[model samples]
Target: MRTVTVEDVTIGEGLPKLIVPLVGQTSEELIKESEFISQLPCDIVEWRVDFYEKVLDFSIVSSFSKTIKKAIKKPLLITFRSKKEGGEKELPTEQYFQLYQEIIQNGQCDLLDIELFMPEKEVSETIALAHQKGIKVIMCNHEFHHTPSMEEILSRLQKMQDKNADICKLAVMPNTPEDVLTLLTATETMYREYADRPIITMSMGALGMVSRITGELTGSSATFGSAVKASAPGQIPIGELKEMIETLKLS
Candidate 1:
């Protein structure tokens, strides 16, 4: 798979890149979180905009985006996840697209996370806009209910690739050990066979925590870690995650 280079971080090459999410609800909290994240040994920082109280105010959101970007000095991934996919807020479809457009035009973030299930035309347009501004797009799908069939998982990933996303990410909740295996099997298959770009796959929750640290073996390009609080279930603390990933490194 071809690697994606954001600043000096090259994903899809070595151990899965570590990504920490900032989910603060206020400007002060966000700034404090960013300061803390800046000191962590992480590869990328994601700003979960839905958690911010003032996220709907474009001017404030844009300003905070710039502040967070400057404070972190790492590749910034701005994501306003919708309520449908385990996010904090619910936005109208038009508003959702408009927010992304504004973000792309502002050029404050290094990457943007676009959901895989959004309308095809809007998703395509948003991705095009982000690319035009030199921002990488991470097309993501999250299934909080249960893991899908291996065929369904691969199909979702293939659709992400067809959308021209710089990176493809899938996060699902596994009900059993076999479900976790299904996720890993599909991820490896996609990486080995169909994928030409980086892909990140994980089975969330306690039952599938093993999937988080097994990225190297399964061909996932990046994994999420938590510094202060986890944005998703089963996110290991950054320090512990770092040590564990190092221990599992293939040399």
Candidate 2:
């Protein structure tokens, strides 16, 4: 798989990159959180803009993103997850597109995460715009309901790559041990067969924690870990996750 590099950090090269999501409701809160996260041992910091109270305001959102950009030395991933995708709030598709375009034009982040479920034309246009600006994209899909079969998982992942994503990411909720295995199986298959770019796959909640720890073994290039609070279900704490991945590397 090809690596996605932002600054000096390479996603597909070694151990899965540790990503910490910044969940703040206010600009002040985000600034404070940025300061705190800069001290953590994380390779990337994701700004969950859907959780920010002032995201609908263009000025506030733009300035706040720039502030956080200056505060962190590592790569910043900007994600405005929609409510349908298990995010905090909802916005119309036009609004979502405009907001993302604005961020890309302003160069606010190293990566912009666009959902795979979005309208096809819009997704392609935005991805083209992002690439023109030299911004990488992690085309994503979150199935908080249930993990699909291994076949479905592989198909969905291949579609993400086909859409010209710099990285393909999928997160699912698992109901049984087989569900976790399904996600892992899909991860390996996608990497071995379909992917031209690195992949990020996780089966969420406690039953799927194994997916988070086993990324390197299964060919995933990134894993999300919690800083102060987990932005997603089943995230292992950043400190513990770092220790686990590091130990695994040595062993």
- Give the top-scoring candidate (TM-score): 1
1-251: candidate 1 lDDT, tens digit per residue: 68899999998898999999999999999999999999999999999999999989877887779999999989999999999999999999999998888878874998899999999999999998888888999999999999999999999999999999999999999998999999999999999999999999999999989999999998999999999899999999998998999999999
In model 1, which regions exceed 4 Å deviation? none
For each candidate in the order shown, give its overall lDDT on alpha carbons: 0.94, 0.91
lDDT of 2 at 51: 96
Q: Give a tens-digit lDDT track for model 2, residues 1-251.
A: 58999988998988999999999998788889999999999999999999999888866776678889899778999999999998998999999999898888764889999999899999999999999988999999999989998888888888998899999999999999998988999898888888888999999999999899888888899999999789999999999999998878734
TM-score of each: 0.99, 0.98
Residue pairs in candidate 1 whose N, alpha carbon or C atoms collide under 3 angstroms: none
Candidate 2 collision pairs: none
For candidate 1, give the lDDT.
0.94
Error of 1 at 80 (Å): 0.8
